[model samples]
Target: MQDITFKHTLPVQLRFNDIDALGHVNNSVYFTFYDLGKARYFEEVKRSPINWNDADLVIANVNANFLSPVFMSESIAVQTATLSIGNKSLKVVQRIINTDTKEVKATCETILVGFDVATSSAKEISVEWKEAISFYEGRELCK
Candidate 1:
């Protein structure tokens, strides 16, 4: 894996309901944290809120690795970074870590594809979106 310097980080609040009978956060709950991280990253990087009703990006695939158990008492945060941008898709990586100890608890990689909801098909990513990401990442993502 390539070393990634995450520029976006969001603190996650754990709810009691997130814990399973095993006294740790359920595996399913980790996905929710990753989702939240992605949302915030886009909003911040784009410098505006996303209108879900007219959103053009959709997740194509996701892969996650759970490195350690997250206890409810742990102070955790999610960090996100864009790995690369293609003509029609972008690769994103996110990790959840303990705020105090900085131990990574879980990591996720996702591919988001640009889609035209009206046509129900994939579309090329917009230049504006690409520029926004490139500027926020502090590096050229387009190849």
Candidate 2:
């Protein structure tokens, strides 16, 4: 897995609707925080030759494992990391944490496939994308 870490401080306000009568954040709401993290990451990654608005990649699959529940009032943040880079696709690993207590609340991994928009077919992930992700990872090259 090619690992890279990116940080996004998810606001509690964004999760306001997640509070249940039981007084804990709903399990289903974790995905929303993951979505916010990915959005921030895309902004950072697309500042190069890749057109942020015109990218041909889309999420083909995603998986999440909830380790714990978060409370509504707690400060939270979602940290995203790349787990793998493939020929025509990539996978991202995400962790939702309680920033105040430094506790991990959930983990997720998403697979994104690069597609040729015109042909509607899978395409090889560009080297530039790999390089940018690698540099952000601050580790040895992924491939």
Report the Cα lDDT for residue 38, model 1.
93
lDDT of 2 at 131: 80
Residue 112 CA displacement from its true place in model 2, Å:
1.0
Candidate 2 lDDT over residue span 33-85, tens digit each: 78778877766665544464567777899898888878767788888877768
Worst 10 residues of 2 by lDDT: 1-10
Model 1: C-alpha RMSD to truth? 0.7
RMSD of each: 0.7, 3.0
**Backbone atom clashes (below 3 Å) for every candidate:** 0, 0
lDDT of 2 at 139: 51
Cα deviation of 82, candidate 2, in Å: 0.8
